[model samples]
Target: MGANIGDNLFSIFNSMTEYMIDAGQRSVLYWDIMRRRGNQYLEHMAKNIPDVLKFDYELLINGRSLPEPVNYGLLKILPPKGVAIDNRKRPFVVIDPRAGHGPGIAGFKADSEIGVALSEGYPCYFIGFTPMPEPNQTIEAVIRGEAHFLAHVNELHPKADGKPVVIGNCQAGWAVMLLAATRPELCGPIIVAGAPLSYWEGVHGQNPMRYTGGMMGGSWMAALLSDLGHGNFDGAWLVQNFEGLNPANTLWKKQYNLYSRIDTEAKRYLEFECWWGDHVFLSAAEIQYIVDNLFLGNKLSGSEIVTSDNISVDLRKISSPIVCFCSKGDDITPPQQALGWILDLYQSVDDIYASNQTIVYCVHEHTGHLGIFVSSNVARKEYFEFASNIDLIDCLPPGLYEAVIEKINYDTVNPDLVTGNYISRFEKRTLDDIHSLGCNTLEDNRCFATVKRLSDVNYGLYRIMVQPMVRAMTTEENAKLMRRLHPLRLGYELLSDHNPMMKPLEWAAKWVSEHRQPVKPDNHFLQWQTLYSDLLATSLNIFRDWRDMMTEQMFFGIYSQDWLQALMGLRASDAPPRKHPGHDPVHLAFIEQRKKEILAGMDKGGPREALIRGFIYVRIPEGACDERGFEMIRRIRAEHHDNHLSEFKKTCREQFFMILLDARRAVEAIPQLLVGREEAGQKFFEIIRKVATAPGPLGKEADMRLAEIKALFIPVRPEQDEK
Candidate 1:
């Protein structure tokens, strides 16, 4: 009996251990399957993703046969539905960033920037390139080509009222700004969405990406990487760096979310990945110049950069109205980087107005960098409102205005649906508001100066010792192979019969679908899963936050220390003091003359006549209402039976000509016109009331004309205001 009991106990323990081992194996298998299944799902989605977006984009050249001019091309867009063909506005040009992606994000949906413009009866032109730059095409060459493209657009729409509005997104933002600065005459309003200008300015712990250069020893790594690529910098590397910044999203969180709701989320993930996966490349020279000069060295904002022909590129030289669109939640190009340039270049708001520049900015509270340009909701609201109200912005006075778009009830009847009544109120902002965003410390500027010097040394060393070997090893065939074998591309391409594990996944997917037991939307299991996922994401973010803080602290500590500053010959203050250089005498005199002419014209007429003219001018459409307003002036001339009417015509003609000569001048004179006219109208009303009530019988014709004039000057009735 004792022997039997011992044997039974040993058997029971063995069975228990076996069961434990089986459970452990099943858990491991489940996790492994989850990862592979997620990847497989992504691959399937990528392969089957439909091109929901339609663009007339002409492919200029295949990167494989590059070195030559474009062999193929297509127009990126066609006119939208429902607009009459004859009256369509000139095409507006929009260029999307090719930083780590292909194009089409700007016009990817019906509620996109391009789409909004199209809906407004504007022809849309998109500037997009292939996955590679032309073999010998430099950035400067591309800039010249883009300028030529704009000139062509101008020719195509010769009768259009204003110049084409060119919008640049992300990396294209700076490119468009450079174009405007260099050739301001070619475009009208320039919109730069989410572009970084003052690269070195960032909050201490919040923006850690700026400190990456200092943490990695100041662009030496960039030089080495370019050398390794044999005189070309693979933009995929840049894409990887972007992914590294948000590891939770790039690694697990994003994929896990898709898995948890794979039935619905698959399409969205694939749409984004299409652009994200299509990596582009930049020549070593281009990437190096951008890094050493703009990113790490911070030269563009400092007025230290020069073009290839040795021409100075100044931001202040851009004469056209600039619209800066930035978002607070955008980690890539935060509000600081977007608005900091104003503080770097100007001393005060007066400086900006003195230059006759209209700089308007709009800040979205919580959109991410990509969402600023791509989110349909944002595109519908911000972009649609911007396109419709661009003329109002163009006509704003020379100063800073924060553009605010408020939605209106559409049920209310209005005259022109296209010109729906919008309450556009411009709030004044000062240079100090812009400066407080992230104007850098003196120590920050000095450190960047040191970085510029060190970059030159590192680049020279690589060219002399390492570049030649790299060039010899990188042949066209090998480059093609390298592209095909890239992990991101290969991961999708290798999931067919080529992978043995994929065979079982097909069966598993079917089985899982057939026997699927999805958690209820509000089930405790789902709630727990969500809580766990949030915890994981929070942990990853905390790690990233800490890492960034450490990186920034280290950078400031090393570069700001007195001993290190001395060794690097870096100054702790801003550059040597420079005297204030005033404005050009010729331009100042011209502006003063224009201002005087407008003021003089308003002073000539009696209060009632001046008020009538002001109201007429504001309401009438340009050129269209020229006849109507001029007719009213002529009627007053005949009826007054006085030389005042004749004198008013002469002054009106002169002031009108001054405005036609320069739109900027005309807009600047509006406020003074409005103020003077209001005062004159009040005075005229008082005088007319006294005359009418006086004892002498009012001249019948004079009384009638006066009544007619008063009717014209009266403000729109409250009932009419409702319309």
Candidate 2:
């Protein structure tokens, strides 16, 4: 009994010593993290002292500031290897979002937008800005600046494929869209990733971030804050808003995650923290324009916002093809917000077609908003496929399509036909298809319309009763102090190297890291620590969900009132139904004229024309199209083209539209295209057969379409092998 008691005491002492050592080590590491973070913040502040971009841009295009103006310039990005661009290759211009963060997140890394384009041999250019906007620089000026930049890019790549494929991330997405709408001739295929064009549209209960604006009153707060900043709104507020959306991430998981895997996660955590902490500021007018016109008023979808020159900024006017990359898991810019504009702009699929526009969308199942742009997996598959097929997308018959990317599998029938690790198929979609994702936004939009009305009233009252007094008391110096005091900013400042309190921490951290005593994974105490962390996170998440639900309920209860909605210019029953622009006589004449031309050319060019027509006919049912089939078309076009690649693309587009308008006549004219080229006709049949069977076995609808096409081309289908 005495021996056992003595043994227990010794065991207790040993355990206590181990606990103390591990605890000491952890405490030192915590201080180390804080110090490193502080140092990083200071470094970022030093670089942004001049507020110039730290991006390693090799070539600067001093944009001719045009009649209006811009303080920013465009630059060509040389890859890390510093390879000179092949001017003859297609030029890829990427515009990084000027939202809160510094530039180069899109390209500085190997797994990024610029990186993908560069690997594909495209001459890559990036549109980035300094920390400061030109005095009184409005959105209009920025748009004009971008237009001139594109013109310069076009001039620089005179021998390259048509025009630069412009890629815009987040805020840049909508900016590019506006630019494309205003100057469609300058853009090739415009890609908008994780951008919310229709802001008021969101799912109920799940997307509660939309309700916060209404619950807290409205844009008056934003306006007042902007006035405080003396015409510049600190972007730290925007980043703060982003943080609030996921408190668990910002408050707990982020720090705890770093703590739990400190040894392995240090480098990555710091890299991301650099981007997250480096906040950028916006002009007061800019944020107001964004909040009022885009977010609250939701005026963009209907072309309510006009250009400086009085042109109505209608999306339908943009003739360039557009590809929207959104994600279902993105709470900020949900698929509904990303794609709801299509429902707003067009009455039907026919309307989209009549407008002579090509809009394709790809909805990722589970990537978050940042992941849509920042994830390497997304860049590898979706972006890589997009870069490879921009030309095909550009030339696709004027219609709506959903570009679907799926992993290639050996089990997929004839997998050898797929050249890459993934296959992207441009399957045609319609307004109804998009509507299925989130058609419930109409009611939500009505509630937001009420909020917008309230904002105007509140803002007017603030201007009259409150603004003068607030402005009198606030100076630029005080405003700077206030911005620095922001919680996100203050945390870094408190933990910074400048703090005398953290002086001893440096020595302690160095010693602890050298003599680290990490807790064992299976330690009971460590397990308890993990359990406590999880319980805290879970409880917070539950509270968040409940809060979201209550907010959603309150929003509907307050704003759903008929009197409130009617007062806000909405109908008692519903908001105004989305409308497409009415077809003007001139537009109708253009369409009639194109139809007439297709009708006239029905019985024209031999085998190639008929073969192309056959292919188009088979794909009338959207599912009939596949990536491998398009790949086949690409090979045939390259092999068969006699002139510039553009000529072949144009020819195919014209022919495809002709067939789309009148499939029976287009198919009937098959023999006409095949006249005097029986050998070519046989080759065409083989190609179509390959296209139909590439992704998988043909379904009934496609098979029937293929059968009709095959019967028409039986004379061309070879009966025996050539000797």
What does each candidate score in C-alpha RMSD?
Answer: 10.9, 3.2
Query: Which lDDT values do the candidates have, in the order given?
Result: 0.63, 0.79
Model 2 global lDDT (CA atoms, 0 to 1) = 0.79
Residue-level lDDT tens digits of model 1 in 414-451? 21222333323345678877776665666666665565
Q: State TM-scores per candidate.
A: 0.74, 0.92
In terms of lDDT, which candidate is strongest?
2
Residues 45-81, candidate 2, lDDT per residue (tens digit)? Answer: 7773322233456646553355765645788776557
Off by over 4 Å in 2: 1-20, 48-55, 62-67, 82-86, 413-419, 569-585, 622-624, 641-643, 700-723
Off by over 4 Å in 1: 1-53, 56-76, 80-88, 409-424, 477-487, 494-500, 503-516, 573-723
